[model samples]
Target chain A: AQSVAQPEDQVNVAEGNPLTVKCTYSVSGNPYLFWYVQYPNRGLQFLLKYITGDNLVKGSYGFEAEFNKSQTSFHLKKPSALVSDSALYFCAVRAYDSNYQLIWGAGTKLIIKP
Target chain B: NAGVTQTPKFRILKIGQSMTLQCTQDMNHNYMYWYRQDPGMGLKLIYYSVGAGITDKGEVPNGYNVSRSTTEDFPLRLELAAPSQTSVYFCASSDRGSNQPQHFGDGTRLSIL
Candidate 1:
């Protein structure tokens, strides 16, 4: 089975400052990772995915995540935060050999302060 | 393109009652999924369909039933509503390949009393 862990329950950062939300995973085989964001009372929107590409993957809203094989981590990062970026972020993973069923994290609430 | 659409944005059901959450996608994608989101638990897949008339259980499929009669419609049924079933249900659709990203609907908020 595959599992994802978002170590932080909440992260606060000032607007225009660099921000990071940590995520790590454990899977038996090659990992297919994804990041999603959810606004209030809305469905989750896909941010980015890491399958078999460069170490860094970029997605919507100027967000990016770095996939580190050695650390078993795929942390979401933004060069500068915006208040509109505040939302619930989730990290999900699926094992390559599995039936393509994804395992999601508990979610991390990101707040961009003005 | 409306991507995915879910009906009855908000619903309240009493314990032991039953209800069905409707989901439809216009993308003509081959993969569709149902997931429930709790306060902090993120999203847990309740069921998924690879194509029309084919369905499979997901991570948390207990007390839930789903059907994929057509390529665009996948509805989830709750046999007996329980407090534990109260959560925001999201319907998503993706292309056939594993490399494609899933598109999600706004979600339906269901509360069990």
Candidate 2:
């Protein structure tokens, strides 16, 4: 079976500061990774995905994630943080075993302080 | 377009009660999925359908059922609701290929007492 993990339950960042939410994965075949954000009582919004391209994948809202095959990680990053950036971040991976269903991490709560 | 839509934005059910959560998509995507989100635990897939009339179990498929009678709708049925089943439910759809990303609905908040 494949799985994803987010080590940090919560991340605190100040406005204008660079923020990073870490994600790691364990899969049998090539990993299809994705990032999503969720606001209060809202559904998830897709951020970006890493299929088989450049390790550094840029996404919406100035967010990006670097896929490190050696590290078995795909960490979400942003050049600067804003108060509105505070939300729940999720990292998902689709393993070869289950090409259609995604294996998700526990989730990381990102709080950006103004 | 309303990419994905889930009805009954919020619902409260008593233990042993039954309810069906409705989901509809306008994109005509070949793939549809149901997932439940809980605190600390990320979204877990409950069921998925590749197309109309075809359904399969997902990561956490217990105490729930789903059907894809038409290409645009996939409804999840919960028979005998339990506290454990109380969570935010999401419906999503994607194109036929694995490379396509899934579009999600606003979600339905279900609380079981």
Candidate 3:
């Protein structure tokens, strides 16, 4: 079965500090991984996706993720954390052969303290 | 471009009442989906449509129905409201292809009492 896991339910970081949100997946074959961010009372916004390119993928709002095939991980990272960056983050994965079905992680709440 | 729009941004319903949540996309996307989000959890897919007149069940399709009559409209129907159904519903659309990002609506907040 294809599944995604976000080990941390919540992560705290001080403003201006580097932040990392961990994610891992278990799939049968090569996986299409994605990250999304949701603000309060709003729908989720696409952050980045790793399809079949460079392992390090850059996305909106200065966010990025590194896809590691060996470890089956795709962790979201940012050089500096901002108060506005605090939100809910989700990791999703889909096996290349799956019929457009995405397996989503529980989600991680990121808190950036100023 | 009004990517994806959902109606009744907020709604309250009494038990046994029925209602439909409206969703439409102007992008002419071939794929549309309905998902429910609880207070502190990830989204659960309820239904999805690949194109007009074609709809299928998703991860959690119980207690709900959906219809895709046209390329742009996909509405979710609840036959009888229940307290457990109280959740924020999101509608999303994606073009015809893999790896394409889905566009989402602001979401509809529904509370069943």
Q: Please name the candidate that would achieve the greatest DockQ relative to the true structure.
A: 1
lDDT of 3 by residue, B7-112 (tens): 9899999999999999999999999999999865788999999999999999999999999989999999999999999999999998887788778899999999
Model 2 lDDT, residue B15, Cα: 98
lDDT of 1 by residue, B1-113 (tens): 88999999999999999999999999999999999988878788999999999999998999999999999999999999999999999999999877678899999999999
Each model's fnat?
Answer: 0.85, 0.71, 0.54
Residue A75, model 3, lDDT: 99
- In the range A34-77, model 1's lDDT, one tens digit per residue, is 99998888888999999997999999999999999999999999
Cα lDDT listed for each candidate: 0.93, 0.93, 0.93
Clash pairs for candidate 2: none
Question: How well does candidate 3 score on lDDT at residue B93?
Answer: 93
Worst 10 residues of 3 chain A by lDDT: A94-103
lDDT at position B27, candidate 2 = 95
What are the clashing pairs of model 1?
A: none
**DockQ of all predictions against the true structure, Cα-based:** 0.84, 0.79, 0.72
TM-score of chain B of 3: 0.98
